[model samples]
Target: MVEQADSRATSFKNILLLIADDLGKNLGCYGAEVTTPNIDKFATEGVLFSHAFTSTASCSNSRSVIYTGLHTHQSGQYGLAGKAHHFVIFDHVKTSPAFFGEQGYLTGLIGKVHVGPDYSYPWHVRNESATRDVAWVADQAGEFFDKAKAAEQPFFLTVGYIDPHRDMTRSGFGNSEIFDARIKDIPYEPSSIKVPAYINNLDESRFEFSEYYSSISRLDQGIGLILESLKARGLEDDTLVVFLSDNGPPFLNSKTTLYDPGVRLPFIVRNPKAAVKGIENPNMVSYVDIFPTFLEWTGKTQHAPTILAGQSIFPILEKSELVPESEWKHRVFGSHTFHEVTNYWPTRFLRTRRYKYHRNVAWRLDFPFSADLYGSLTWDAIRHSQPRGKEGDILVGQRKLSDYIFRPPEELYDLDEDPLELVNLAVDEKHKERLLEFRGLLEKWQDETLDPWLYRDGVSKRFIQHHLDAGMIVPDRFDLDLENIRIR
Candidate 1:
């Protein structure tokens, strides 16, 4: 253990991780709706990361990356259901707590352990639990903190809340009053949400946007409760608090898509011992870096399990003058696996500070809307109750790919000009040089990462068919050669 003077002098620094499900930059602190005083307080007091991103967009894959410090390809988690097939930080790498636990620190997790099935791992703590309710999570966390305090053990507690995620059939939709009263005045209409010109502006697209904002407000309230509990327990100052979402916001072109809203998340870290306070860092940081950062903060000596794809932001947090400019500037690479129950294909992206490039190998397949399964049920039941005609038609139609593929195989977006990714510069001869540069970058990343199915859709297609034949998995609509036909 490489104990620093300050770290050893003080009672061990406890870690409190609060993760919200499907949360985007829609809070007051992030320049959007929903007044999250607790989160805002943490932002005001801590290091606010402007460019922090998840390795993947989907929940399970992103969480796995955060836990393991490995990319999706390395971990083998392509989507939510793929949790069973992958290696998590809890499974492969030495977890922050296990290392700290060996050093006499108590560790526990509460609320939403969606990483894998009920499988055992190296750092698995039997004390951890998960729940969808916010109040219950706060109570459980309070109890855990109290227990850790009683034992006089330094602690690492993770609290995950399932909010802002698309509401399940029975899980009552967003809190209407909270949305109408607190956020309705925000001048954001479904029409105001400029969808990419290439995207089909179906009626369902507008309704989805409205529902997404409602969910954001609901999640904010849950975060407020957790923060209050921490303060009541007197663990605020001693604990190094980190507030981040598991993945990007769930929306049409975001959650499963390799875009900014899908991968970029609000990262706020508040450590009382750090020299810097209330600073907005534009450095590109990934979830993988978190493992090393936590260890470094606690004055522990440990390297990432493999060559980490992420770099630590401890220097930025401490306001160290010795920190190099190169350390802060780095491109973030993102990957996505088969989302929903179907084999919708996979995509990989590279995002620099000013630009973003996407290489969708499975460009032939349509965007799979996982919410459609639940939405169809609701639409059918309330067909007569809600608006009819085009509005209802859009809501009830099958999830199909839009006409964006008419352009080019590759996509190049100047994030500065088009944050929403409205324009594709891949075919523009003026930017051919930039397109080639990013394409080369993406290809290099794919090869180096050992992406299992990169440019190998035939391999994935065969794998899916093999699984179906062997009774390993089954789909509603089975087609061995899906590339030749449009099932929906």
Candidate 2:
């Protein structure tokens, strides 16, 4: 292993970030049953973050936070692929790539760059990349790296893979023919999969979970190829390689929700030159911390253009004396916006080490779990299962709006006991104080972050009304925001 001088050990001239779409803790390193030898190997040589999480659950929203290092409620992108309106991290400030480029690094992005409209940002080179073939991407990235090395310029390469997202064309929900059939042997049963009571268990749900495992394996193959390319080009030692996902698996109570499976992501960082190695850091970190951490790692201290809500992890990387847990146990927040044209469910979540609380603003009934208009037919079939008997008559007959109104508005879960978030303790009098405390904290965060959706009578209403006028959405029959809208 190449070691850096102790004085400049933290400095990195080149950085390579690999982001997998919809990749959760399915790899072998995170105790999943999937076969990800290459990813596991990488984890063994680097620091694996046990408590890393994203700021939002949806694609565009989470990517916005990752790029800008701000919460989704702060970035103003509460939905999926759509117009670039509201506040955006890239819009208001220079991105991590741009900052590194200014410091004499050639920065480029390969694969999915689903932040906003394609025409908005021009600073980074966006490659016309897709996740159809892992080998092809490895070959392309190898060529890019070789050219950058020949030019003698440090590079910031972001390889985004859209694997395992969804194959709406597939018959088995998330299954894709591109994946090796060996994935079928992975042990994942619906009976073994613990889900929340809010979601009805069905045969299709199990099939969907099985398909999710298959997709993860396929993406792992792509990651293997990328790592091999780096080693083949002899750039493994010099490059700071980081691997993570934008959000959790897209399933019921997962994607577009503030649950742990939705926001918690796999985070791994490997710097062969750094002093630290083979360590699992249990410290809690968020998407907001990435930009500042990258900046600090590159040996730059300039203030970012936008208001950064993240702190630098340079001290941790340097193997300094352990910081108090209270110092690092900061609250992480998340939010959701209009996912599809017709479906509107907005929610905010607050998470700590032991507890997680969710506040639903606009709930819907009879709506699909994921608003993936382009999702695979297999996923759709699994999500819309028929109720068995009159015992489920209420769930079977209600409209999406009615379901939303009847659902619990506040949810509190002790993550230590229910890592899967299967139980709710919000109504328990013993936990009432804790719920109120988190609610108060959430309200304070909302006010301080300038969340546009908090006040119903201000520009937020104007914004919604404007979208309504533009035919973006229709005022639903059970819209709760319209009834309890506060003028202030």
Top candidate by lDDT? 2
Top TM-score: which candidate number?
2
Give candidate 2's root-mean-square deviation (CA, Å).
6.7
Model 1 CA deviation exceeding 4 Å by range: 1-10, 82-103, 117-132, 170-215, 318-325, 372-401, 404-408, 456-488
What would the per-residue lDDT of candidate 1 be over residues 1-488, giving only the tens digit for each residue? 33443344247678888887877776778776454666777787888888888877777778767765678777665667433334333345444545666766777777667665344222324444433455566667788877776666678887766666666543333433232232332223566553323223445545555556555655665566667787786677788888899876555455666778778889998887776788787777888788777877777645435555666677666442334656564688878775554645577888888898987766667556665333533333433343444433432222222332222357888989988675788889999999889887876777677666554324543335556577654332212356654333
Span of 10 residues, lowest total lDDT, candidate 1: 396-405
1-488: candidate 2 lDDT, tens digit per residue? 23433223224367889988887776789987667888998988888888788887777778777776677667666666654333234355556765776787777788888775443444355686655566677777888887676666677888888766765554243444454432333435656654333344556555666766666766777788888888887677778888999887765555666678778889999976877787777777888888888777677767554577788765665342345766665467777765543546667788888899987665444334554522634345433655534444323112232332345667788989887664678889999999989988976777677676553322354346567577654333223456656433
Could you tell me every candidate's TM-score relative to the true structure? 0.76, 0.80
Candidate lDDT scores, in order, read 0.64, 0.68
Clashing pairs in 2: 168-375, 168-376, 173-378, 173-379, 365-400, 366-400
Global CA lDDT computed for model 1: 0.64
CA deviation > 4 Å runs, candidate 2: 1-12, 82-90, 117-120, 170-203, 317-323, 364-368, 373-406, 456-488
